[model samples]
Target chain A: MDDILLMLPGPTTVHPRVLNAMSQAVVNHRSKRYGEILTETNELMSKMFQTENQSYLITGSGTAVMEAGISNVLNAGEKVLNVVGGKFGERFKKIADAHGIKTQELAVEWGTAVTPEQIKEALDADESIKAVSVVHNETSTGVAAPIKEIGKVMKNYDALYIVDTVSSLCGDEVDVDKYNIDVCVTGSQKCIAAPPGMAAITYSDDAWAACENVDSHTFYLDMKAYRKSGNKDPAETPYTPSVSLTYAMNEALKMIDEEGLDKRVARHHKAANATVAAAKALGLELFADEKVSSATVTALKIPEGLTDSDFRGTIRDEFGVELAGGQDHLKGNVFRIGHMGNISYKELFQTFAAMGIYLERNGIVEDGAAGVSSLVKSYL
Target chain B: MDDILLMLPGPTTVHPRVLNAMSQAVVNHRSKRYGEILTETNELMSKMFQTENQSYLITGSGTAVMEAGISNVLNAGEKVLNVVGGKFGERFKKIADAHGIKTQELAVEWGTAVTPEQIKEALDADESIKAVSVVHNETSTGVAAPIKEIGKVMKNYDALYIVDTVSSLCGDEVDVDKYNIDVCVTGSQKCIAAPPGMAAITYSDDAWAACENVDSHTFYLDMKAYRKSGNKDPAETPYTPSVSLTYAMNEALKMIDEEGLDKRVARHHKAANATVAAAKALGLELFADEKVSSATVTALKIPEGLTDSDFRGTIRDEFGVELAGGQDHLKGNVFRIGHMGNISYKELFQTFAAMGIYLERNGIVEDGAAGVSSLVKSYL
Candidate 1:
């Protein structure tokens, strides 16, 4: 089988340099050299998240961070407002429920962003709420919520603000301190351009304060223990971390550093804009509003007469360009084009060229060249 | 500096094939190809663990498996017998304590094996004990417990037998069904010869019965969810796993299959015997009794007049050989040599040669060549 380009919400296309980094010989997790690597990675994570808060390189999926964010910060029976806008957003309530934390869902329609007004209303109605969990970018619907605005509203309350930037951290601006996010968590496979396995999480003083009197009942995922160990000289994870993934993450972070976060975010914006513009030119509607469209993944409504399988399967099996189908309730109704991580403008252009030919042959669009023209115009 | 030979208990030197495996491009965890890989890996793990029982490839450290094993099988307030022999053995009790589980410590001295009589006594003393947690190979002290004997005793009781074969699974003989172990857990970086980050665990029917009534408050580490997902035609993990690590683990397991389990165990035994013979010839005392010495890692008493730092540092800095130092109260009192994983007998002899030279230069021993001679004799 030939190599297929990854165009999913996560487990993005890793750079060859980053993938090769995983081939480095295994080092003792407690060795001095490992400590140096970990400390450097931690610093890079803080810079990437735009926060001076204490950070951790935890070995688990992004969901581990979500669970830790809820398990550590809120005590049992304490109310936490979970902002539900999409599938990933709804996960906050599920995690909270699992932890026995009382939760009230601040529901927002799928493909719509959660507003500051909604957050304010939720917090105002519940003075005893200990935390507010929000997803910075809803991957399920490709909508980036107005976290800065929500953060401003959350400042008036004593609740700890937790944000899931799993699909948006480096691809979009997630200024943790500016947003007053007490905890910001992300995974390696998304915008970090690393493989799936570990998550990078940051915690503010407020977040720690909330965990002070809490009984997290977890030993492996205990945030406090990780914090205690990570704060030591040279920094370290509490247990043996996935060193191969950490090495790959270090290389990925280095690439991000070379590209510059601002330029990287702009690159993502350009890719997303080009994808959205081309889809529209091809007579496909955007699933998310243009104002709230995620810079990481662009969701497009499936055109009539084209089955989800026909669309994605042709893109993958025929052209070797793998595009992600919609998730959850939106499955078969929409398709997603992931523009995050190491995907280049050339690759993005090629992806559209292939999509153009497919659309024209399938009679979904009259002119394949029109989509190419729009993509070129957007790039310019 | 130069490439150093890893001689630690875990994160041992990975095979070149396994390292190359890590360089495979990232794939979507939910994709069909990924599902195939997962299913194949699951079958391999079941074989590797010497069980036809259900297995899960959890994305975390060996400690994660330990926590998951306890959290999933037994509930809060359930009494468990923790066989405390070394640091890893004691962790069973620590994890149980963190989860609010009632624990009775069947304490055994470090560097000593726990007897079946001790286990029988503990179980006989407590009729309500729900589980018995034991470490098959205590990496901290290089002691392989009498699990087969302990298994015989547990057969007479209703308590579930949970064995941690983290450092022993592939290096030594551990027939799960033969031992009647209900829950067996191991890690990737140990005898499996893969990188750290994942734990391979198996559960017997008896263990699943215990979990049926248990409400493990974890969403990420829940074993039941993994079991359900993995039982699908295309096996899947409950959450996004470390795909890179899984790839490496696949290659590592393949190597084990090619080498044959019986031959692999013999190789480990040969490597261990050579190291022990060489160390004893150099006037060093074995940390664990020879009767129960582990085939994976060999712990040795640090000769007097040589600080642990001076001992291990010289081996690492001068000879490019990294040996693990003792942990906890045994810190600075003992050193460990890991012979498990992809390390060859040639490297073992080289390591002994290097250690002998370091011993001579540090005035810890008179003759360096005598150690090499002993190693050669043992190999013959």
Candidate 2:
């Protein structure tokens, strides 16, 4: 198969070093050596989150830990305020509902973020709300919420704060402690650049305390079990973890450490800024609001006289660049270009180059080189 | 690190091809190509299961699917007969308890299999039982239940039959259809020789009907969502799958197809027989009853004077052969040798050679070569 540039929100382009790590031999999960690896991986994950709380690695996808974050801290019949701006934001409400927990929807525009004032008002309006759930970066619409500002507002309230940083943790700025995030979740396949099937979650002392009152309805995702097992001498997960994926994650995190998180985050920001500039140069409008645009992925509106499949299909089949189509309500109207994880200017240049050709071929833009020129200017 | 032989019951030694498959670049889980891979993988899994019922792959450990098997088809307050003979068998009851599902425990001796007559009697007494949960191969005790006979008994009852074949599925005789299994779950890292983090489950028509009546408490492992996504044109998983792990599983399943399931089962049986005979030659007793011993793993009683750590530790640190020690109450009294998934006569001979040296060093056996001689004789 030809090498295709993965420009999707997640399952992002992984570095060869990370991918090679996945080929290492499997180890016994209960062994002391394996436990040491788990300990190191968890510590690195905690450092990435910038939180004092220990991170617990899970063997499933990001959604698994998303459910774990909610189910572990809240009980059935408890009210939680769910900030629904995009697909993932709405998922918190759905998960709460699945566990019989009551949710008060604080719906926002799909491409816009919820303001701190809105959250404060919602919490002030209902004293019964036990928690406030938000998505730090909405992958669906390419919008990033102002979590630090919201954390200041949450300081005045007693509701636990839970955030999903599945796509933005390492790519963007995420200070879990500064944000007062009671429970934070991220997937390995996103900004971590590891393979899918592994996720990590961090829980604050407040969240652990709340868990005492909640009758957790899950077994595989029970945070208490994870905590008990994680507290062992060498540190371990409650169950058998994805050993190969853990190896990949360890390598990815090591890469992040070597590159420096600050530099890595800056590179991601540069990629996002360049993508936005390229879109503007190509006479394309972004799907998300400019003020709240994400640093990990950028969503662009489908150009006039072009279909979603025709546009992305030509780019993938002809140019070997795979871009993600907008999901759910935004399907066929927008496309997303993911610029997270080991993505550098070379991959970004290639992506915009293919996109420029597509726009020129479709007569949406007058010049084919416009997007690449914009990216080059931004990088320089 | 030296190449250590993984002789654990579940996370068996993985083949190089399967490991190499894990290094492939990850693809979009929602793409048509990925869906086709999912389709092929599910088909191969179904074939391995020997069931017409479609199999759904889960991106978690075997324990996750074990929980899914219970929480999806059985509701809170419903009764289930849990046949507990070993650690894994007891896990079903724990999962049911976590979901508020009532469980009637049918406790059997640790090293003995539950007879079909006992199940028939239990079902006859409990008309309210909605399901019967059993572990086909008990890794903790190295016992394989008579699932075929149990299936015949289940035919006379209205309760759904759920079986866990995590360590035994591809390595042992598991005719899901002939066994009349309503639900069967297996892990990827065991007999499949794939990496950890993926599991597959099969559900019958009756199980689906029961799922409709039950309010699934889980969102990640919800069978309804999996069924809906799996019924799509190319077939897909509800959530983002472990993409790299799926690739590895595809290669592992392809390897199984090449070897032929019958030949694989016979090889596993032969390995198990050789290990048992070797243990007898070394004057060590088998932990489980010889009649019900597992084909995938063999549990042997630790020699009277040799500690579990001393015995397995020497083999691991000196000889680089990793073996599993007993769990819970059996700790330090027994040790298990896993002979599943890509294990050959070469690996077996090496294992016995290490065992012989350890026995001689510990003064447990007069002749150090007794075990290897027995293994050679069995193979000849």
Q: List the residue pairs that clash in candidate 1.
A: none
If chain B of candidate 2 is superposed on the true chain B, what is its TM-score?
A: 0.99
- How would you class the docking of model 2? high
Cα lDDT tens digits, model 2, A142-216, are 999999999999888889999999999999999999889999999998898887889999999999999999888
Instruction: Provide backbone clash counts, one per model.
Output: 0, 0
- TM-scores of all candidate predictions against the true structure: 0.98, 0.99
Deviating ranges (above 4 Å) for candidate 1: none
Clashing pairs in 2: none
**For candidate 2, what is the total of clashing residue pairs?**
0
Error of 2 at A42 (Å): 0.4
**Candidate 1: lDDT of B268?**
94
Model 2 C-alpha RMSD vs. true structure (Å) is 0.9
Best by TM-score: 2
Report lDDT (Cα) of residue B253, candidate 1: 93
lDDT of 2 by residue, B1-380 (tens): 43899888978888889888878888888888889989999999999999998999999999999999989999899999999999999899999999999999999999999999999999998899999999999999999999999999998888999999999999999999998999999999899999888999999999999999998889998999999999998888888899998999999999999999999999999999989998899898999999999999999899899888878989999999999999999999999999999998898888989999889977888998999999889989
What DockQ results do all the predictions give, each relative to the true complex? 0.75, 0.81
Compared with the true structure, what per-residue lDDT tens digits does model 1 show for residues B139-250?
A: 9999999889889999999999999999998899999998999999999998899999999889999899998989876888888888998998778898899998889889
User: For candidate 2, what is the lDDT?
Assistant: 0.92
